[model samples]
Target chain A: MVVTQTNHLAGTEALLERGRDLSTPLLRAVVDRLAPPMDTVAAYHFGWIDAQGRPARSDGGKAVRPALALISAEAAGAPPQAGVPGAVAVELVHNFSLLHDDLMDGDEQRRHRDTVWKVHGPAQAILVGDALFALANEVLLELGTADAGRATRRLTVATRKLIDGQAQDMSFEGRERVTVEECLEMEGNKTGALLACACSIGAVLGGADDATADALETYGYHLGLAFQAVDDLLGIWGEPAETGKQTWSDLRQRKKSLPVCAALAAGGPASEKLAAMLAADAKDGDGEHPGAHEDFSEREFATRAALIEEAGGREWTAREARRQYATALAALDGPEGRAMPESVRAQLTELADFVVERRR
Target chain B: MVVTQTNHLAGTEALLERGRDLSTPLLRAVVDRLAPPMDTVAAYHFGWIDAQGRPARSDGGKAVRPALALISAEAAGAPPQAGVPGAVAVELVHNFSLLHDDLMDGDEQRRHRDTVWKVHGPAQAILVGDALFALANEVLLELGTADAGRATRRLTVATRKLIDGQAQDMSFEGRERVTVEECLEMEGNKTGALLACACSIGAVLGGADDATADALETYGYHLGLAFQAVDDLLGIWGEPAETGKQTWSDLRQRKKSLPVCAALAAGGPASEKLAAMLAADAKDGDGEHPGAHEDFSEREFATRAALIEEAGGREWTAREARRQYATALAALDGPEGRAMPESVRAQLTELADFVVERRR
Candidate 1:
């Protein structure tokens, strides 16, 4: 199989825009079906309205998950429109997770605005998440396709994994340390499962064979891994202005992200230094929990970030992200495997790279 | 149109037992598939295991929701087993709501045991609820039949309404007064929707025609309303030991149940006295929030309950319960209806009576 070089950057961006254009309105319509207060919270969360129920000028987050679903459908030898419901479903599920996640983490800001929980209250946020989840299932079940049941099953399984991952993530917070392997599995469940489902559900919805679905699922799983790796990197090192977070956000939070866990597992001199810094953090009266952000001074956050980097944790994660990205691309190459059309394959490859290399 | 007065109490009990036998293991299995921590929380919530993960002698819930599904399936002309998945799905959904509702309502105990949130904390309770919900949909979608999608849709719509109802219920807490109609609508959405789905889902899975499904849904909706009316009565009037609550539970908690709302709307002497008592409650430095339970002196609680009854609120609620029960039974008597087999009809009528009249 000859893999040719192609600049799918602009094309991929256009496809993402197209996917968002197609799915956002459907998602809005589905969420609008929620009862009064939940509908208002959902619309506000989606940036369609503000807390007072007035129209708001807000551009939503990048529709990455929905883009993957739509693109995968095309790769499955079907029109992208054939996968609109899948796209809508995945996007709704993603937002559902985000809403709950923001609440659990006690996050105040998201997408440059106050989180739903911060604005409406935690109870309302929980209900909104639930409504979105139900809406996702409802949309898929109404697809009128043979794959409807199959896709619904995939989405549900992925959602279960996501919940398990969240549970593990929360459990890890109270503990002093976690193994790298455990952290990896948590990330896979939290992030990878949904992405895998996104691709597989699209193929299933597009009437693709099982083999085709499996290939995209594999691609998506690895892509999700790579995406998290890059996110971990950004959490520690990306410019605050670019990432829309505080300086050294993950370090200040003492989150058990890939790099932090990797450094703790290194068990070397630099690792000792990082551990000491973290130990001091516990006694420093920061009053910040693992799942929440900190009001750390810039110097303290920078020191922790540097200590982890010196332990080579940052480099390890960056390399792993690259490796995962390459593996994802490799999974897409074969006569039987890379059965997707060239244009769609190029688009996926570009999208995969974006996941690995995104600055924000 | 011959509706005979026959004893169906024993027969209804047998059906409930049979439904529990069929659905409990399946529900357990699905919940067990969650990760360990979540599985533990879910098991505890379902009364399968103790908070310590030890074998505890705990009688499970009545399994009324599952029983509705199974019996409805039989009424729709299918074998009970054909509705097992539907039964499991509805039970799981019901428990999911219970788990979240406990958290949102700050309920410390349920079914005479500590709530999942009380035992494991709010975050874990939330995740467990989400997992159960996903598992419910997963179980339905895995059904190797045409009705899988249809059943999933019904459950989703019902779930959405349930969430909406909860949001409304929470919002109602902040207000000084709520209309009886608003209270009834909230009950319909929160409780009626799920029971309605329980009935309609079985009918759909049993391959019932649209007419049959709609009629059964109507029956379940009215049944849910009647159930709530009785529940509200128990909240204020039942023995604490039997009801597993404090003296005058709803009054102490200041829950705007049917009687309270009716009295508030009545604008009679009882209504004025009740309002004055509640106003005194606000000034009593109780710091009453919707979800939090209150500890009131027995005398105070009894006085409040007596005032509500003297206002005729209690009688009004009791009458409404009977009216709704009659309406629910009447829903089953049309020419194209009463499609349920004789045994199932008798069983259903008994169940409806139990809802309206049960002491605990």
Candidate 2:
């Protein structure tokens, strides 16, 4: 299938902006219900405040999931306003995971800011993350509709999958071998499940039929795989200035992301060499623990990244991303998509394109 | 108002045993749905498995919350089976908090066994806690009824309050002064809210009206306060063998538990002395951090406990427990209680008596 290379970046930006406009206020209002320090900490994590608690406008995120939720509602022939709860719920779930994952993964920075755990502490991180998850369900269940109930079940199931993915990812770090299929499965759980939920929850809340929601979910599932592939690529090759990370970040941390898994599974001389180097790194104790790998030099990370690329990891990942992107777009044209408004389909397609092609 | 001193411990045990019989299978089934390591970790936390993953019948806490739920359902004229979902949901939320609280409080032991974070790692603790929370909502939502939806909302709200209470409890540790009222509020949020929900959520699932649920919830709210008061007394003076904690445990940690707060609020000579000692302890760097107070001697803890007792903290706390217990029992005789079956009311009264009188 020939993929369109149209520059929908501007359109996607507008869509994300619209999503932020719709969801941010409700998100803020919900978070404000958190008691004292949790509220302040959540505000800091959302970039609504400086570390000192002064109000500031910093990058929260792209609001990609919320945008998808809003569009999915439109796809179900409902007004965007009908999907606000879904949008906010998914956004809350997304941020909730971000908070805990930052602590679990020992990530110090996100969106060019110190992580919640880093800024406040690990206890606050755990508590605030939990509070947000509870708020996500509250936002849905408070609607007191049958559709809202259905949407809550969907969001919670997705959350479990997201958590399952995290467990798998953490487990993979200790093992010397991880198959490409396993890596993809982990990514599917960690990132794909929630995205899939976000893509269809709006439709579910808008009182759409199961078929339409399923179709939108399928579209989102593929989009999520594609998004993870791109993210894996950028972890190694993207510019630090754009990505808000250092050079060869994943390689430096020895994360067994998609690219590394694919290349290790390739089984060539360079792949074997890469595997040995990684195994040795794991033996050095730094690989066993997160945030303990700072001893690796830039030159070492460069060498590892180059070996991964030479073993065809980079090329394979890029191709997989494009293939997934094509599949995601094809979902929008299927039988269920026929019922969606043409404008909604166009917006979803634009967003998918932006997801696959963006630098960060 | 005369309080009965009749012994109902035997009947309460039977009731709890029935609750455990009804809820454990379903709880295990739900927890089994967690992926891999999480399932294993949760199994370990629930005391169904040893640290080595072999089966073991460890000391899981008394099934107090589940019993409350089942009895609440009975109060609404529904069979105990009707409250199974509510029972499992509250139990899950309770365990979720325990897993996180152990890590945050740096408590290495629980119920004569190592805590989840102590046995597993902190990441597993956080992840397993999160998974259990998600599972709680899922179990209720999977029932697929409006009552189930309402119960889920109630559970989530209680969960949020539980988290809020934890935040307050943690913040209290670093402060030099904490009021009796503030301590009570923290306990209410941390312990009372979940108990309140447990007491009413079953009625909600059994299609009870707002008046019934409200009355039951009030009963639970006071019962929780009574429970906390007893817990505070035990924290200071209960036998280590029965309580599974060291002697003067709260004082060793320099905790501002209800007893400490009440003693400080008394304003007598002993209260002033106790305040000075605690303030000095706070300045000694141990109070600022949990698990960092090992330097305090046994004699030091004994002296602190004696000071608290001398300041009427112990007597006041015991009286408060009795007062709350009376209030809790009185709820069953209120107007809303008139609709409840006589047997259910008797069972609830029995449970309340056991709660305030239990040694552990």
Candidate 3:
């Protein structure tokens, strides 16, 4: 199933290329202008250099946020180029999260290379994350509302949401139990808010009416939720090469992923058994490592996965994601979704499908 | 000595009030619009609330950046109000650094309370810090190109310097050895860049010519260095009640402050002995216990502090700070400085003196 979607996503390269066409020049200029001193350890975290200060090759990411922002903007009737500032802003925010997330998760690997904190140390990584965030804010401010007082209000509101979402996500890390509803709320705020912001900001920049902006925001929000659902699926069942990491890695990390929540929500024998497994994994043992679990034997792992599937975890999520994608499509219910000369709406629909269907 | 300076700084509260008067309304407005839910954590850190999320009196900071900004702008003949955006931006940058510095130093206490990380946890503290940085950028965008694009350019450059300086400061943490030149350069970037940024941004906003902006930048740079030198002195020799932390705490923490650099550079019998003490303290046991030095014999500590003073470190740094302060004052030589209204000039001069003399 993952392989089929991966192949389809490959066909979206042209859509992504169009996004790059809109985003790259502006992003490059921002990066060039804001590049820190070679001596600053945080510079190494940006993947521009090695730990010893030697130059490196492309420190590139998939540019997912940029593509999402641009597609949503175009789907809302604006030309793709109009969303360039927002595309760059969202991408910076994503990268900032990656840098700090690496530190928090203690994952020393990112992009098939040493994570920022692994190579440059946590302090430097923290600063690099900070610099990226500062740049994102600068990008917004750089595109002022022609009215200072009004613009300040909008940007500050958007920024506050971004920060709040991040706080909630981080606070969830050590908690032993969380509900499906809680996880959805977290994803909605942390990941979806920015995606919604990208679309809303794009619509505003495109001079759309308030109704159109709200619709685009809804479309982006639902799309982001669908994207996270797909991501959760990939984390558990992804192929190593496709996912760019080990399979079932989220499970290894004992993350409270969506499927796990679904199993919990089912409240059957499997749910109770899984809860015990999770609780035991989190407990500290006397004079030994407590996170190491002895209860979940290999046979039990297989049964647990089967029970999760039986409980309608992955299937339920996938169906819901498709429904949300359709809803996002419906929200564009006007000339904004259909009027683009380039069949831009079709491209956006395909991209939305790609987000929820991708294995990795 | 530190007590006297604290008393003097207390007297300058009226001047600080004047600085707040320049931009408090806009700053407060921005703070208000920071949006709720997400701002709860940030508000707590800023001392606007208790940890449980109840509102309280706002804990005041010196507002040094805003003060310097307003002073520099007015001295350059720009209306102080015209530079309020720049003032807010610099203050935001200053606060951003403080948030991260507390994390890096592992100093759980800040402003006589638990630091952001201690209260909200590191991850949330990190996000809050990033949010402030983004806010700073938003403030910069508000400045617009009121006088061509020069102010934006100055701000961008200054922000980069602040990041570089902070990066350098963090990088110096793990190293076993450092040179006086390296330490000075680090301090210049860490403490000086933002002060320089405050002045440079102010002058640019005030519509100063390139030459006058450069002069303000120079003034701020030197002033910051002198201020840091005085701070380093008090860090080791000042009273805890005056400095708001333990006396000689920097020495206990093995910080590479200016006086320590001077002592190391002296490189005589006392210097060698001090070196031996530091080396013994760092690696004398199995490398497992860096903090085990808390158990160091009293005789070892007295000998180390004595070696530091006997090397003429304290006196040398004090004189050097005075020299730098004089140099900073000299950098204010310009048409703008000469044109300042007598009242404003006196206030600005007194503010500079107050910064140089601050004990904490």
Question: Which candidate do you rate higher for DockQ, 2 or 3?
Answer: 2
Shift in Å, residue A242, candidate 2: 1.4
State how far residue B349 of model 1 sits from its true place (Å).
Answer: 1.7
For residue A181, model 1's alpha carbon misses the true position, in angstroms, by 2.3
* Alpha-carbon TM-score of each model against the true structure: 0.93, 0.98, 0.79
Candidate 3 B-chain TM-score: 0.87
Candidate 2, A134: how far from true, in Å?
Answer: 0.7
lDDT of 2 by residue, A1-360 (tens): 244655576788899998999988899999999998999999999999999999999988878999999998888888887889999999999999999988988877788888999889899999999999999999999999999999999999899999999999988887788999999999999998999999999899889988999899889999999999999999999898888767787776667899999999999899999999888888886444556577878788888899999999999999999988989889888999888999998898888888888888
After superposition, the stretches of candidate 1 with alpha carbons farther than 4 Å from their true spots are: A1-9, A276-298, B1-9, B276-300
Residue-wise lDDT of candidate 2 within B43-100, one digit each (tens)? 9999999999999998889889999999999988899999999999999999999999
What lDDT would candidate 2 get against the real structure? 0.90
- Estimate, for each residue in A291-329, the C-alpha lDDT of model 3 and write its tens digit: 233345556555656666777777777776777777777
Residue A76, candidate 3: C-alpha displacement in angstroms: 11
Q: Candidate 1's error at A55, in angstroms? A: 2.7
Ranking by DockQ: 2, 1, 3
lDDT for each residue of candidate 3 in B1-360, tens digit (9 for 90 to 100)? 233555456546775776788777776666565534447766777677888888777555667778778877776677777778888877776777788777766665666677887787666667767777667666665444544245544564566666666665544444556777887888887788778878767767777787777877888888889888988888788777666565466765667787777887898888887777777766754322124345666566567777889987888888878877788777755665565566655665566778777667
lDDT of 1 by residue, A1-360 (tens): 123224545666787898888887788788878877788888899899977889997857877888888887888788888788998898888899999887777767777788998898878888889889998988988775668878888888889888888888777765567888998899899989999888777788988887888888888888898999998998889887777666676665567899988888888888998888777666664433434435567887777888788898898899889888888888789554556788888788878866775778
